[model samples]
Target: MMRAELAQNFRQLELKKKLEPMLPVLDFIAWSLLKHNQDVVSQLWVLSKQQSWRTSKSIPNSLWNWICSAVDEVTLDPMTKHAWLLLSDD
Candidate 1:
């Protein structure tokens, strides 16, 4: 059991390492989609998961949801929207 657990942990770590490089690109795509169409947030999440991006385990997923929910809940000015895009870029 210990050996299995250790193997799983190592696999997860390897996956994370592979994913690290793609994170910025994914974030940029998600942010750009959100800026134009709020309705596509769920689709973005689904696509991310489908691509094996581990959306639930990543910061970009949470950030995307938060920004989309905020936009849905309250009207953000253009400046605020741009700020979010800039922040997500980092």
Candidate 2:
């Protein structure tokens, strides 16, 4: 039953950075599904797809454009820098 619950909810923590100890859980999910005659490849394919875009709230194009333009690009003035300050090439 814990395996079934993990299988249902694991998608919420599937990213590489989030799942250091999750390999066994993933393996169990896949093996359990295979044992039950379910399609493992398709299930993995669905899990592998990026979900970041779906979780982020969608803003209208106009709003996005306005937000992007709200900040003015500023260049550092070397003449105004402190003598000991260093600037690195970006």
Candidate 3:
């Protein structure tokens, strides 16, 4: 059991090392999409990137979902919204 746990831990650490470098790029992409009023969590977009990640075998499935979810949860403050559109109910 100890050996199994040690192996699992080692594997997870290696995965972390591989995936850590990707976090900044992922975050930037998500931020840019959101800034441009695009959806980061869109199925169409997520599916498009799957092949590359799968080919590299770096990013796991759950990580993609989590990144999308994290990006999706971010809301642009109204104060920071562009000046082009005036918000009114009329």
Candidate 4:
């Protein structure tokens, strides 16, 4: 499913040497998050925090704003919309 596809994408990125020094940490975080079956918002939050900490700077507001914009562009079904609403409520 989505987890397998994401893992494959990560592997492809890694093979291109695009991840570099952050690869191990990013991979571990991604796998752990996927294993826990966390929601997309939660995963993004954790990844953003990790990226900020790894880079020794606060994550840019623009990055999160962009994520929001991207999410807004998706045409969610009823169940998905409900899930998104619940996440937004939190």
Every candidate's CA RMSD: 12.2, 18.6, 13.1, 17.0
> Residues 12-41, candidate 3, lDDT per residue (tens digit)?
999999997786577557645665444544
Tens-digit lDDT track of model 1 for 19-80:
87887677667666676675586577557678983445645655556555765454445565
How many collisions per candidate? 0, 0, 0, 0
Error of 1 at 21 (Å): 0.8
Over 1-90, each residue of candidate 4 has an lDDT whose tens digit, in order, gives: 699999999899887776565655664555455645546755666676677645534444443444465464445455556543643322
lDDT of 2 by residue, 1-90 (tens): 698798767666566547745544554565446644435544553465444344223433433443475578778878898899897777
Positional deviation of residue 9's Cα in model 2 after best superposition, in angstroms: 26
Q: What are the lDDT figures for the candidates, one per model?
A: 0.67, 0.55, 0.63, 0.57
- In model 3, the worst 10-residue window by lDDT is 36-45
TM-score of each: 0.38, 0.22, 0.37, 0.21
The alpha-carbon deviation from the true structure for residue 47 of candidate 4, after best TM-score superposition, in angstroms, is 7.5
TM-score leader: 1
Which lDDT value does model 2 have at 7?
77
Runs in model 2 lying further than 4 Å from the true structure = 1-15, 36-90
